[model samples]
Target: MTDPGAYPNPGQHPSPHGQPPRNKRRVWPWLVIGVPVLLFGACGVAVVASVAGGNDTTVTTGPGDGDAADGGAADRGPDFPGKLDDDTAAPAGATITRDELAYTVSPLEAVDTVLGSYLCSTVTIDNVGTSQNDFNGYTDWSLQDTGGAIRDATFGPDRPMLNSGQIAPGGRATGSVCFDDRTGAAPGTYVVLFEDTFSLSTDRLAWITTL
Candidate 1:
């Protein structure tokens, strides 16, 4: 007969109700696998939330419709040409003479457009310099509203556009320089700026006026 002392008695590992202890090895493997699965699941959720949060804070520019409806009026850079500076600002109807060129701007006249109105100013440029001076209204002039939005010179319907060409000394060129103010968007004061290519001056001429 086997010695009862050599083999442990089943009563030593009995449950509270005296039943035999069940094998827990199978449950331990399942617990180990489940814990890692739960940890990975939590990590995936956190990563998705982080990605979603990043997308919510992105910034964009231009109109709500994503089109340049105002002729790119609101898309000015910090170094945009024809900005005012010291000794470069003038009032409306003033004849500013610099580098032998006399620039006179009259009060703006509102020319109606299909979408909005055009603020057209009669500009007279007198070439008093010894040499002929070249002028391009679309390329060398810009208009700025009180809100700091700048627009390039544009042509209006049934309006006389400014003539651009070489002006002989003692000669004058006069016409209308117009800016399209889409749907009265710019309804306040406006500034007419001229890039002085004659002097190559950084501080361009600015004539202040209102609508």
Candidate 2:
């Protein structure tokens, strides 16, 4: 028989079916000690893993630190022709010559859409001669279809206006043509024309088409 209030006999373990004597020391002390130790060990492992993962490593390269050597030596000279002197003479038969006029259809090309569409054309006149040339009184600019049907064109504010205006040598003037009305014309080859009063000549500038 065992006394209820008495501790179990020394060197004799009591059966678990009987109520064990209470440990006066609070069990919360072990919980507090174990939780902090486990948390600290987990934090230490996390820090070690972060450092070992090399998440902070960074490499930097300076101007000349690569396999390719710096080819930009100070002694290297320009590969193209430099500025020409004012006294330079023009080549033979180059008197007041006009360059091949260039025209562009914007948005550079045509747009393909099931609905309505619009596009602009620009003609660039470059004065490559040594002397200034007057561009005044140049008016008739139009777009024509392949079948010889002429499309009426209007000049916007950016169009080349001669009104006694002169473009200096090496200067350029841009004339714009916009097409909004599409009645009989479908997507096909078209020719843009620029007629000037200076020489009574007409220039078939560009051949473009729509999608």
Work out the TM-score per prediction: 0.55, 0.37
Q: What C-alpha lDDT do the candidate models reach, one value each?
A: 0.65, 0.41
- True lDDT of residue 69, candidate 1: 15
Worst 10-residue lDDT window, candidate 2: 86-95
Cα lDDT tens digits for candidate 2, 1-211: 8675565556555557876555478799899899999999999998777545421111112224321111122211112122112111111111112232212233212323454443345445556567776653234455555454665454334333323366787787655555433544455555444344444222222333443
Report the number of the highest-TM-score candidate.
Answer: 1
What candidate 1 gets wrong by more than 4 Å, as runs, is 1-84, 114-116, 183-187, 197-199
Error of 2 at 176 (Å): 2.0
Our tally of clashes for model 2 stands at 1
Per-residue lDDT over 67-152 for candidate 1, one digit per residue giving the tens place of the 0 to 100 score: 21111233221232335333255456766665556677887777786756888888888887799977776767888876777778
